[model samples]
Target: MRVLVYGSGQLAQMMYLAAAPLGVIVSAVDVSNETVVHPVSKEPTGVSLQNAIEDANAITVEFEHVPEHLLLDADKSGKLFPNVASILAGADRVREKALLSKHEIPNCPYLIITDVTDLDNVIASLGERVIFKASRDGYDGYGQWRMQSADQLEKLKSEFAKLDLVKVPLIAERMMQFDREISLVGARDSEGNVSCFSLAENLHFEGQLHVSVAPITDLSDSLQSQANEIFEKLATAMDYVGVLAVELFQCGEELLVNEIAPRVHNSGHWTQQGCDTSQFEQHIRAVLGLPLGAVDVRGVSAMVNIIGCTAFSRDLIGIAGAHLHWYGKEVRTKRKMGHINVVADSHSHLGNKLAQLLAFLPVEHFPELEAEANRLKNYTK
Candidate 1:
């Protein structure tokens, strides 16, 4: 079987690696050139984009930012996994909010702002601390603005009013104060069999994910049940097939959907080392109409992203249970270079390993590592 993925990025590279042993070929489309390209080697595959789409058994995406025309072209092929609408729901916040409401899934309370006038009432209702996000294209904290006080509303209105709101309207969500953030990744096969991975506790810095710990150390039955129920309603509602990631904010005992990713996601990266079958393989299986893989949490696992700085040691691999996945991309500021997966028989052991891993790196480049490692080591169930 052959699959085509849009956006030749690390996700596509990892998917290609995972699919190879499954007797499947995964190719990529360089959204920049809009042509078939090799995912790992980053070379031309000599397959025209048209022929690639025509020949593939399935088509998917590495990210949601692929141009609309490319998505429309693939949509016409009827081979797009998760479908065009589902992909659009992920790329556009307006569509995402509507989908959540249509399924009665809880999301942040807010209003749409298509005009400067719209912001006034939304601010009055939601509060001055609303976070305005571009509805069409925004991710990892880009295309986002924060309103700290009502005094700044006029300034924001004057500056933002000039924008072509019709082309990229804004979604204003109340800046929620939640206990902690958690993410749930799950897969739905073509036959609609759904399997959810463990709820992972995520730590982020400047809107980029830094670390993730799976099984949550203390995942309550209530939280698990609620998360699965939400995932089922969402996947079934969209007729979604393949891996879907839902990011949530836990408020007291309840969870509210923050956003949904329609493909395999960063927070689920621990599965590459922690689960019997990784999420990338499960995603391929789902789109190919195969049985879903077991998501049993193998052990206490932590995923630490190697962000921006590439100075970290490959000697990190010398540590027991440490698995490194290097993306082989040019290093740039705040870029996701790679990730380290560390597993242990228990959560405490995993935390200690994380601490030791941090010790081998420069503290200046990895300040966040210390706090998270200490939290994990001192964590209470």
Candidate 2:
């Protein structure tokens, strides 16, 4: 079977690798420029977008911000998973918030801002410390502004004055305290069957993900059940097919939805080595109307993102349980160049492996490696 994916990036490349084992052919569309390419090598497939969609048995996405026109084309084929409305919910923060509220799902208290004047009341209601995010095309820390105090509001307003706020409004979220960020990746088939991977503890640097440890340490049954129920609510609400990732905030024993990614997620990368069946494979199965793969965790796993620094030695593989997957892309600041997956029999052993692997990377670019290792090392059994 053939699958056409939107966005020819690292996520598409990983899906290509996973699909090969299942005898599936996956091609990617550079949604912005409307170019078709091989999901792995990224060479032009020399096929028209219309023809590509016509030939595919299923259409999925590596990211949600695909152009609406292409999505409409794929929808006509009746092969698109999760549908255009579901993707739109992820692309637009306003729609996303509405869905959460509609389902009675817990989320941070917030307001929508369509004009600079609206910001005044929102600030008065939500307070000074708030995060303003563009409703569309915002990711990896871009298209966002933070208000720390009243003085910053005018500056923010001026900066955003030229923006077409009416066309793409802002989602102003209250900056509330939480213990840490966690995420769950799950898959749902056309039949409404759902399967979820273990919750992952995530650490982000400057709004970008840096490290994720799966089957979270010190996990409670209640937390797992809560995450699973949240996933079920979302998937069933959208009649979502394929993988869906939910970023969440942990407040004591409660979990609040942070954002939804309607595709394979960076935080789920650990499944490549930690689980019996990876998220990529599971997504493929879900989109194709096949039985979902096992989401069983083989052991504790850590996935460290190789962001923007290409000089690190590839000899990290010398360390036991380290597996590297490098994206062949030009090195640029803040780019996700590749990732390394590390697995261990125990969290302490995982910590030791991480520290040992750290020797091969420059500390200046990877200071968190040791800190995370230390955290894991402190855990017993």
Candidate 1 segments exceeding 4 Å error: none
Q: What local distance difference test score does each model get? A: 0.90, 0.92
What is the C-alpha lDDT profile of model 1 across 1-381, one tens digit per residue? 999999899999999999999999999999998879889998999989999999899999988888989999998998899888889899999999999998899889979888888987976699879899999778898888898888888888998888988888899999999988899999998887889998999988888898899978678999988999999999999999999999999998899999999999999999999999899999998988878888888888999888887887789899999999999999998899999999988877888899899866666656578888888788755
Best by lDDT: 2
Give the lDDT of residue 179 in candidate 1: 87
Model 2's alpha-carbon lDDT is 0.92
Model 2: per-residue Cα lDDT over 339-372, one tens digit each: 9999999898899999998888877766578999
Candidate 2 segments exceeding 4 Å error: none
Clashing pairs in 2: none
Alpha-carbon TM-score of each model against the true structure: 0.98, 0.98
Candidate 1 matches the true fold with a TM-score of 0.98
